[model samples]
Target: MNILIVYAHPEPNSLNGFLKDLAVETLSAAGHEVIVSDLYEKNFKAVADRNDFTELNNPEKLNYIQEQYHASKNRTFTSDILEEQDHLLWADIAIFQFPIWWTESPAILKGWFDRVLAYNFAYGPGHYDQGNLRGKKAMLSITHGASSLANYGAYGLKGDLDERLFNIQHEKLFFCGMDVIEPFIFHSSTKEDAKEGLFNDYRKKLLNISNEPVIPFHPLSHYEKGQLKDQYKTSIQQELEMS
Candidate 1:
């Protein structure tokens, strides 16, 4: 499988970096092609602006969505954005590896999504199940500075991790038609004592990731006027309850 690892950690020796490297090594050893986009190393631009487009469709007004749609159609996106978009299109599985900051991905990674998931490419009318990334997969490989048992959802101090990631997994990846693989989250990642064991488990997880569980995101058809159909409601509720 073709895998693209979009990594965002400032330090090369950090935990996120180690896991990113491990993923590349493990997947490549397993005969899967892998590519890593070390955002910080690349010095990636973290904010979207008019410069995103090579030539302006309307220079006066900076309507990002409008420009993205036109730029995607005209192939007028700047080189950096275009390059990442190409990688995104080429990948069968896209893994995002980063250390959680303020309950979210670092600014650079978010910028990647902002500029790379161009309109008319990643999302538009007839998106969701029919979106451009319909057959692709997305997985979050994240590290957080909190204890798994204490901060892990299901009535934990931080509520639910699943809920925290709903916008990303559901609104972003799923909305773009990518089936999200269950996230691989490491809690208290700064604990040096747990690093070796966690690394071992992470390597094993990467090797066996294809068999891991995928979150149940009902298809667009399962909704009626933007809500779950009556017949699907019970099952959806049951799944949420079980989670």
Candidate 2:
């Protein structure tokens, strides 16, 4: 299987970087071809603006979505964005590796989402389970500063980590029609105690990732008027406001 690891973190010596490096070697040893888009090393343009499109449908106004849709049909997206899009299409799965900053992915990853998952290509009205990237798989590999306190649910100092990741997992990954697997995270990855055990776990998980199940995101037909039918809500979604 082909895999793409979209990594974000400025420092090569950072925990996020080390994991990304390990992923390349580990996944490759498992017989998977791997590609890494090191955002910082590439100096990837993190901001999405008019520069994204080589030609514009409406030069007078900056209608981002409309431009994206137009670019999708015209192949007018710049080389950088096009490269990332090509990497996505070529890969069987994409793993996003980053630290949870402000309860979300780093700004560069957000930019990657915005620019690569363009309208008419990644998503549209008939998206969700039916989007263009339908058959692919996606997963998150994140680290955070908080310790076990993050797992304390609503009472946790950081709130529920699962809940906090709902937007990224459900809204973004699932929205793109990929079968998103449950995220693999290393809490307090920066701490000395968390390093060895967590790194070993990550290596083991990658070797067996092919057996992982997709997260239970019901298909579009399961929705009515753009809302999930109540019966479709899983205990996790019902107990915690995942949507």
Candidate 3:
């Protein structure tokens, strides 16, 4: 399977980088075509701008945007936006690796999503109503500075790890049509030295996601239909009761 690993750690010497490398090697060894988009290394621009929004009504401008779009799809180097779009199209699975900061992804990574996953490409009108990214799979591989248990929505803590990624995982990935796979999170990434075994175990887990329990797939239309599926309906109700 073709795999695109989008890594978003700033420091090259960080454990996040090491984990990324390990993942690359493992995936490559498994004979899966692996491409790493090292956002920092590539000096990838994360912000979107006016040039990105093509006006379809203006004939001259619409022609220009059409040219740009074709050039992008044809790989004539039309724009970075097209280039990233191409990568997503070529891959079957996409893995995002990053560090948790302020209960979210680092700025650059978030920016990557903001800029790259654009309208009509990732979602919205003229795109696949559901997961224009359909037939693809997505997973998150994140590291956090806090203790693992504390990150849980339960344990008198924040919320479940999955809850934290609801937007990016379900809303974003699923809306775009990618099958949302379970995430592999490592808590206390800052305390790696004291948790060598945990790191190894995490690595082992990362190497085995094909059979792992995936994050529950929640369709955006579910709510429109008035409620979540049976499993999630029960789980959410239970969560509310516990709270």
Candidate 4:
């Protein structure tokens, strides 16, 4: 399998960095062709602006989506954006390795999404499960500062980790039609023992990625006119008989 690991962490000696290394080594040893995009090391840009395009669709006004759509159609994306997109296209599996910051991925990684997942390529009309990246697989290899219990259940301080990551798993990867794997999340990874445990678990997960169960996302067929089909309503919605 062709794999791409988009790694985001400043310190090479950090826990996230170590996991990134482990992923490359383990996957390569398993006979997969692996590529790592160390965002910080590459000094990737995190903000989206006119710089992404070589030509403007409308010089009088700046609409990023419009410009991106035009650029994508005309093959005018900047060199950096094109390079990342090329890597994305070459990979069968994409693993995002990052430490959660302020409840989401770091700015650089987020920016990578903004620029690389271009208009008409990643999403537009008939997108989400029908997007250009269909048939691919994606997973989040994440690290969190809080303990597992703190991020669990109704009473947990951080609520549900799944809920927190819904945007990335459901909106981003699923929208692009990639089978989203259940994330490998390590909590309170500051300790030595925790690091060891995380390493072991991650190695196992990487080796079994092809067989991992994908997260269940409602198919496009489950919606009509932007509303979920009647048979697909949640229990709360069913009880309330929401119209």
Candidate 5:
């Protein structure tokens, strides 16, 4: 499978960098075509603005979303954005390798999503499960500075790690119709001894990408008029109903 690794760490010697390298090496050794987008090295612009388009839909009004949609229709995205989008289109799987900052990906990576995943292409009407990226898969390879226990259940300082990543896994990747794989998190990433184990686990995950269970997401069929079917209300919603 073709794999695109969108790497966002600034330091090449960082743990996130090692994993990114390992992914490219391991996937390539397995005969999969691997492309790495080193955002920092490339000096990728993290801001989405008028510079993203060669021509604007409304030169007077700077509505980014409408401009993106119009540019997509006209094939007027800037070269950098078009190139990244093309890579996304070519890949069967996309891996995001980044260190969590303020409980989210770095601004550059977020901006990459804003610019590269054009409105008409990555999403629009009949989106989510019906999005343009339907058959592709996405995985998050994240490194967290906090310990695993600290990011765990009720007593932990931070809530569930999954909850922290919901915006990226659910809102972004899943919104684009990519089958989301459970994120591989390396907690307490500063520890040196964990490197070998982390590398091994990551290698296994990469090699078994086809077998990895996808995170369950409500399909388009489960929604009627933009709301989930009554039978599909999550447990939280059910609890609220009881209250």
Candidate 6:
């Protein structure tokens, strides 16, 4: 299978980078074609701009933007933002590798989503309410500085790390019709003692993705019928208060 590994880390010598290398090497050694988008090395921009969205109606006036977009279309994109889309198109599975900063992804990875997963490419209520980018699979390979318990419900942390990513990784990706694959988290990846073991585990997981069961979204029957609005409202209020 063809795999695309999107790596985001400012320092190439960081633990996250080491895992990126391991993942790439392991995948290639297993006979899978791998593509790496090193956001920092590629100098990816972390912000979206007018050119990205403004050229939607006119293709002619969008000279530079079109070039970038086409490069992304054909897997030849050199610009950081557009290159991601191209890589996604060429891969069978998309793996995002990054260190969680402030309980979220690095700014560049966030920007990659902001720019690459655009209106027509990712989603819209039109087009039969189906997304343009469908039928793909994705997994997140993340590293965190904190201990695993810090992200679990037992310790009163927000919830499981998987729950925190539901909206972005699973819901968003699956809503766009991609088969949401289980994520691989390198808990406490920043610690030296844990790094080697976590890296080895991650490599094994990626290599054996075909054997893992694809987790489906929770059934709607699991939610209360009339209490949905109230529940979300309360959750939003609590989140605002905490923030």
Candidates' C-alpha lDDT: 0.87, 0.87, 0.71, 0.87, 0.88, 0.69
Candidate 2: where is the Cα deviation over 4 Å? 189-194, 234-243
RMSD of 2: 3.3
Taking the tens digit of each residue's C-alpha lDDT, what string does model 1 give over 142-221?
A: 98887565676698898787887886888888889898898988875447787688889888888987776778888899
TM-score, cand. 3: 0.78
Q: Please give the clash total of every predicted structure, in order.
A: 0, 0, 7, 0, 0, 0
Write candidate 3's Cα lDDT for 1-243 as tens digits. Answer: 888999998887887898888888888887789999999998777655445544333345444334435433444332666677888999988999998888888888887787677555666543322646787888888887765566565753666766778878876777777776778777754454767776677667656756656555545544545566565665544666778
Across 1-243, the per-residue lDDT of candidate 4 in tens digits comes to 999999999999988888899999999999999999999999999999988899998988899999988987987989888888889899999999999998899999999999998878777765777877999999999988885546555667877778889989888888877889989987754577667876798899999989997887777887899888997776433545665
Whole-model lDDT, candidate 6? 0.69
Off by over 4 Å in 3: 53-78, 125-129, 155-157, 189-194, 225-232, 235-243
Better of 4 and 6 by TM-score: 4
lDDT of 6 at 35: 94
Clashing pairs in 1: none
TM-score of candidate 4 versus the correct structure, residues matched by position = 0.92
What global local distance difference test value does model 2 have?
0.87
Query: What is the per-residue lDDT of model 5 for residues 1-243, given as tens digits with 9 covering 90 to 100?
Result: 989999999999988888898898888998999999999998999999999999998899899999989988988999999999999999999999999899899999999998998899798864778888999999999988876556556667877778888899988998988999888888754467867887799899988987898888788788899898897787534555778
| Per-residue lDDT of model 2, residues 1-243, tens digit only | 999999999999988888898999999988999999999899988899999999999999999999999999999999999999999999899999999999999899899999999998888855888888889999899988775654536878778888888888888878888888778887763468767888998898899887786777778888899888887766545645656
Which model is ahead, 2 or 6, in terms of TM-score?
2
| lDDT-better candidate, 4 vs 5 | 5
Error of 4 at 135 (Å): 0.7
RMSD of each: 2.5, 3.3, 5.1, 4.0, 3.9, 7.6
lDDT head-to-head 3 vs 4, winner: 4
At residue 243, candidate 3 shows an lDDT of 82
Q: For model 2, what is the error of residue 29's alpha carbon versus the real structure, in angstroms, after optimal superposition?
A: 0.9
Candidate 4 residue pairs in backbone clash:
none
